[model samples]
Target: MAALEISKATRRIASTYPSLVLFQLARFFLVLATEMQAVAVGWQVYEITKRPLDLGLVGLAQFLPGIFLFLVSGHAADRYPRRTLLVLCYCGFTLCSGSLLFLTLRGLHSVYPIFAVTVLLGVVRSFNGPVSRAFLPQLVSGKDFQTAVAWYSIFIQSAVILGPSLGGLVYAAFRGPAAVYTLSFIAAALGAMSTVAIKAQSNPRLGEPMSWKTMLAGFHYIRSERLILGSISLDLFAVLLGGAVALLPVYAREILKTGPWGLGILRSAPAAGAATMAALIAHKPLGHRTGSTMLWCVAGFGAATIVFGLSRSLTISLIALLLVGATDMVSVIVRQLFIQVSTPDEMRGRVNAVDMIFVGASNELGQFESGLTAHWFGIVPAVVLGGLGTLAVTALWSWYFPELRKTEKLHSPAP
Candidate 1:
C-alpha cells in the first residue's frame, strides 16, 4: 500500500509539471542547435582568417544587437504572449541557421557574411533570453520554483554536453560547415513546434502601456536589491575576465595541436562537468550558505581557469576546463534562483532582460575582451591575466556585498 501511494505521488509530481517539462524539452533542442552552430562558426572562421581577433569579432557582432534591444525586448516579452513570442524567435533562429548554410554552400571566402548572420542571431537571442526566463515562473508555483530551476539547468547542460560533440563529429565527417548548419535549422524548427504544443498562458502585464519608466523598472529593481546587484555583477566581472571559450580555436590549433575532433572535446569538457553538477543539484537542492558557497565556487572557477591557461598537455587542459564548468554551474544556479524568486511576476520579463544584458556583456563582450587582450599579449598571457582578474573580482565582491556573502539560504523572505 505504501509503495502504491509513493508511486502515485511521483506520477502526480510529474503530471503537475507538464508545462515545465515541455519547456525544458524545447530549450534542450534549441540550445543544442546553438551550441553546434557555435562550434561550426568558430572552426570555419578561424580556418578562413587564421587570426585570433576575428574570433573576437564574431562575439562582438552578436553582442551589439543585445545591447541596443535590451530594454525593448523585455518590454515586448511582458506585453506579448510569451509562448507566441518564443515560437517567432525560434523561427528567426531557423532563418539564421539556413542563411549560414546558404553562405557555406556558396563557397564563401570572406568572414563578413558569417558575422552578419551572427548579428541576426544575436537579435533573436536578445528577445529569447528575456521571454524564456520570464516564462518559467508562470509554469510552476513559488514553492517548486527552485527545483524547477535545477531541472532546467540539467536540461541546458545536457544540451551543452551533446551539442559541441555532435557539431565536431558532423564537421569532421562531412569536411564542411553545411551539414552542421542544416542540423541547426532542423533543431530550431523542432524547437518552435515543441513550444506550439505548450498550453497558452496570459501575461500579467499584457495591458500595460510602454513607457520609459516601465522599461527601466528592471534596472531600478536590481539597483534596489543589493543581493541581486551583487550576484549579477559578480558573475559579469568574473566571467568577463575568466572566460576562455573565445580562445579555444587558437588553443586547438596553435597550442593543443589538435584538429576539429579535439576542439569539440575541449569545448564539451566544461559542459560535461556542469551537467554532472546540475544532476546532483537537482537531486538535492542547495540549502545553507548559498551566497558564500557561490562565491567560493566562482573563486574555484578562477583557479581552474588559471590552471587551464598554464597547462600545455591536453589532458591537463581538459581537467582544468572540467573544474571551471563545475564551479560555474554552482554559481549559475544560485544566481538564477535569486533573480527568479525575488522578482514580482509582472516584472520578471524586464528583470530577466536586464539580467540577460549583464549575461551578454559578460559572455559576448568578454569574448571581445579576450580577443583584444590576446591580440596585444599572447594567448597564454591573456588567459592567465584574465583568471587572475577573476580572482580579484571575487574577493572584491565578497567584501563589498556582505549581505550576499552572509546569505544562508536560497529562498527570499519577500512575499
Candidate 2:
C-alpha cells in the first residue's frame, strides 16, 4: 500500500512537473549527508570540550553567517542562476566536509577548528537555503504545489530518520568520526552532480542593479503582509524556544547514560515522528480549519517539549520527542504553503531568504540560547523553561495575529 501510494504520487508529479523527482533526489543526498555530518560534529565537539557552552558555540558559529549575509545571499539568488548558485553551495559543502575529515585526521585538542569549519558551512547554507526554498515552487504546478511541499518534507524527514542511524553505525565501526566525514564529503559532491543534472530552466535575473531599495524588498514585503508576518514570527519564536535538539548530546551522555548510538536514535526520533505527519498530510489534505490547526499544533509542540524535558526514561523521552516533531510538522507545512502561495516568483528569493533567516535564528541561535541557559540554569531547567516560553509565545501570537489564527484555507500558488 505504501509503495503504491508513493508510485501514484510520483506519477502525478511526473505528469505535472518531471524535474521534482530529480529535485527530491538532490535533497535526499544533501539532507542525509548533512545530518550525518551533524551527528559527527556533535559527538566530536562534545568529546573535546565537554562543555555545553561550546556545543552552543558550534550552533552560533553556523548561524552567524546566515545572520550577516541574509540579505546579500537572498539578492544573489534573485540576481544569479539559483541552480548554479546551489551547485556552488554544494561544492562548498563538499569542501567543508572534507575539511572536517582533515581536522579529525589531524587529532584535535581544541574545538576552534571545528567551530571555524562550521562557520564556513554556515556561509554556504546562508546562500543555499533561500535559493533552494524559492526554487521549489517552480518544480511543480500551482494546484499540486501544496501537496508537493508536504511530500517534499517527507523526503527531508526520511533523511532525518536515516542519517543519524547510519552516522552512528559508521562512527561505532570506525570508533571515530573520520569515516563519517568522508561519507559526508562524498554525498555533498553527489548533490552537486544531481543539481547539475536538473534540466529545469530558472529565470534568475541580472538586470536588476543592487540598491538599498532592491535589497530591502523582501523585508518590506513581509512587514506589510500581516498574515505573513504572523506566521513566520510565530514559528520563529515557537521553535526558537521550543527546540531541544541542541541539548540531545547532553541528554544522551548525562541523563540517559547512553553513548553515540543512543544519541543517534534520540536524534532520529523527531524525524520519525515528522515522517508520520508528512505522510498523513500527503494522503489527506488539511481541512478548512488550517489556521486553528496550526496554532494548536504549535501549542502541542511546546507541551511535548515539556514532557521530554521532565522525562528521565528513554522510552518516555522518545515518545515526547516524537510528539514534538509531529506537532511541529503541522505548523511548518501550513506556514510553508501559505508563504509560498502568497509570494510572487520574482520576489521569492528575497522573501524566502528572510524566512530562512528566521528559521536559522530559531534553530541555530536558539541553540546558543539553550546552551547559555543550560550553563547558567542547568540542562533540565533550561529545556523546561524553553518549553514554557514557547507556550507563552503561542498564546501571545494567537492573540496578536488573529489573521493567522482565523485563517480558513491555504492560498493557491499563482500560475
Candidate 3:
C-alpha cells in the first residue's frame, strides 16, 4: 500500500511537470560543459602565470558583459522566444568551448586569448540567464512551481557535483587540457540539441516594445518590493563577501599541495553538499519560518568559509567547503522562491535579469574582489576577512530587513 502510494505521487508530479524534466536534462548538460571549461581554464591560467590576480581576471572578464547588457538582455527575454533563445545561447557556448580547444591544441601560452573567449561566453550568459529563469514559469503550473524549483536545484547541484570531478579526471587521463575542452564542446552541443527538443511556449510579453522605461521596469519593481529587494540584496552582499571559489586553484596548488585531480575534488565538494541538501528539500519542501532559515543558513555559509580559510588539512578544508555549499544552497532556494512567487509572469524575465546581475556581481565580481584583496594581503588573510565580512553583513541585514527575517512561509501573497 505504501509503495503504491509513493508510486502514485511520483506519477502525479511527473505528469504535471514534463517540461521541467526536459529543462533539467538540458541544463544538466549545459552546466556540465560549463564546469568542465571552468576547471580547464582555471588550471591552465594558473599554470602559465602563477598569479592570483589573473585568476580573478578570469571571473571579471566573464562578468563585464553582464554589467553592460543587463537591461537589454532582460528586455529580450520578455520579447523573444525563450526556448529558441536558449538554443542559440547553448550553441554559442559550444563555439566558445571549441575555440578553447583550438587554443589548447596550438600550445597557447598567452592568457589574453583565453580571457577574450571568456568575455564572449559571458556575453552569451548575459542573455541566457534571464531567459532561462523566466522560461520556468511556463513549464509548470502555479501550484507546482515551488516543487519544480526544488527539483530544478537538485539537477543543478547534481551537475555541479559531477562536472568538475569529471573534468579533472579527463584532464588527468589525457594529461592535457585539450581532452577537457573537447569534452566540454561535446557536452555543450548535446545541451543545445536537448533544448531544441523542448516544446515551444508562446511569449505573452512578445508584443512589449523595447523602451527605456520597459528596460528599467524590472529594477523599479524590485526596489518597490521590500521582500524582493531585501532577499536579493542579502544574497548579493553575503555571497560577495563570502565568495572563496575563485581562489580554489591557489588553495589546491599552494595551500593544500594537491594536483588538478585534488583541485577538481575541492571544486566539487560544495556541490556535493548542496546536492545532498537539495535532494532532501525536494523530498520534503520547506514549510515554515523560511525567512529565518535562509538567514541562518547564510550565516552558516560564512562560518564554514572561515573554517575553510583557516584549514591546512585537505580533509578539514573539504568538510568546510561542504558546509559552505550546503548552507548556500538553502539560501539560494529561499531567495529563488521569494523571487518566483512574488513577481508576476510578465515581469519574471526582467526581474530575473536583475537578480542575475546581482548573482554575477556576487560570483564573478566577487572573484575579482577576492583576488584583489588576496593580492594586497595574502590569500589566507583575504579569505578570512571576507568570511568575517559575510557574517557582519548578515547581522546588519537581519536588523535592517526585519520583514524578511520575520516572514513565516513561501506562499505568494494575494495579487
Candidate 4:
C-alpha cells in the first residue's frame, strides 16, 4: 500500500511539472556537509579554549556579514541569473572549506582565522539564500510550487539528520578533528559540480533600477504583507529562543558525558525526525488548518526543548531532541508552503531574502544567545528558559497574527 501510494504521488508530481529535485538534492549535500563542519568547529574551538564565549563568537563570525548584505543580495538575485549566482556562491564556499582544510592540515590554525573565514562564509551564504530561493519558480509550474517547497525543506532537514553521523565517523576514523573539515570541502565541491546540471533562463531585471528607494520598497512590501511578515517573525523568535543546537558540543562533553559519536547522534536526531516527517509529507500532506498545525508543532518543539534541557539521562535527552527536531520539521514545511503559495513572482526573491535574514539572524544570534545564557546560568537552565521563551513568543504571535491563526488551506500558486 505504501509503495502504491508513493507511486501515485510520483505520478501526480510528474503530471504537474518538474521542480528542482536535482538542485534540492545538491542543496541537501551542501547543508549536510556544512552542518557537520560547523559542529566540528564548535567542538574544536571549545576544546581549545574551554570557554562558552568562544562558541558565541563562532556564531557572530558567521552572522554579521549576512545581516548587513542580505538586502543587496536579494536585489542581486532578482537582477542576475540564479544559476550563475549559485555557481559563484558554491565555488566560494568550496574554496573557504578548502582553505580551512589547508590551515588545519598545516596545523597553523587559530580561532581568529576561523572567525574570519566564518564571516566570509556568512557573506557568501547571504547571496546564496536569495539566488537559490528566487530560482524556484523557474523550476516548477505555479500549482506545484508549494508542494515543491515542502519537499525541499524535507531534503534540507534530512541532511541535518545524516551529516553529523558521517562527521562523527570521519572524525573518529582520522584520529584528528581536521579530517572533518576536509570532508566538508569535498562535499561542498561536489555540490557545486552538481549545480552545473540545473538549466535556468535569466531574467535579470524586472523594471525598477537599484537604489535605496527600491531596497526600502522591499521592506515596505513585507511590512504590508501581514501574513508573510507574521509567519516569518513567529518562526524567527520561536527558533531563535528555543534553539540549543549551538550548545550540543557542551552537552555532549559535559552533561551527557558522551564522546564525538554521542555528539553526532544528539545533533542528528532533529534531522532524523525531520527527514521522517518530510517523507510522510511528500506522500500525505497536512492539507488543511496549516496555521493551527504550525502553532501546535512549535508548541511541541518548545516543550521538547525544555525536556531535553532538564533530562539527565542520555536516552531521555535523545528522545526529547528527536521530538524537538520532528516538531520543528513540521513548522518548516508549513511555513515554506505558506510563503510560496502567497508570494508574487517578482517579489519572491526580495521577500525570501528578507526571510533569510530573519532566519540567519535567528539561528546565529540564537546560538550566541544560547551560549551566553548557558555560560551565565549554566547550560540546562539556559536551554529550559529558551524553551519557555519560545512558547511565550508563540502565544503572543497567535494573538497578534490573526491571519496566521485563522489560515486554512494553501492556495494554488497563480499561473
Q: Where is the poorest 10-residue window by lDDT in model 2?
A: 199-208
Give residue 163's lDDT in candidate 2 (0 to 100): 87
TM-score of every prediction relative to native: 0.87, 0.89, 0.88, 0.87
All candidates' lDDT scores?
A: 0.87, 0.87, 0.87, 0.80
Candidate 1 lDDT tens digits, 365-395: 7887898999999999999999999999999
lDDT of 3 by residue, 119-149 (tens): 9999999999998988887777666666777
* Candidate 2 per-residue C-alpha lDDT over 122-195 given as tens digits, one digit per residue, 9 for 90 to 100: 99999998899888887777677778888889999998788878987899899999999999999888888888
Pick the TM-score winner: 2
**Runs in model 3 with CA error above 4 Å?**
1-12, 42-56, 102-113, 200-203, 247-263, 310-313, 371-381, 412-415
| lDDT for position 267 in model 3 | 83
- In model 4, which range of ten residues has the least summed lDDT? 13-22
What are the candidates' C-alpha RMSDs? 3.8, 2.8, 3.3, 3.1
How far residue 144's Cα lies from its native spot in candidate 4, in Å, is 2.7
Please give, for residues 162-279, the per-residue lDDT of candidate 4 as tens digits.
7776776787788666888888988898889878877754444575678987765568777997888888898999989997888898899899999877887887788777777777
RMSD (CA, Å), candidate 4 to true, equals 3.1
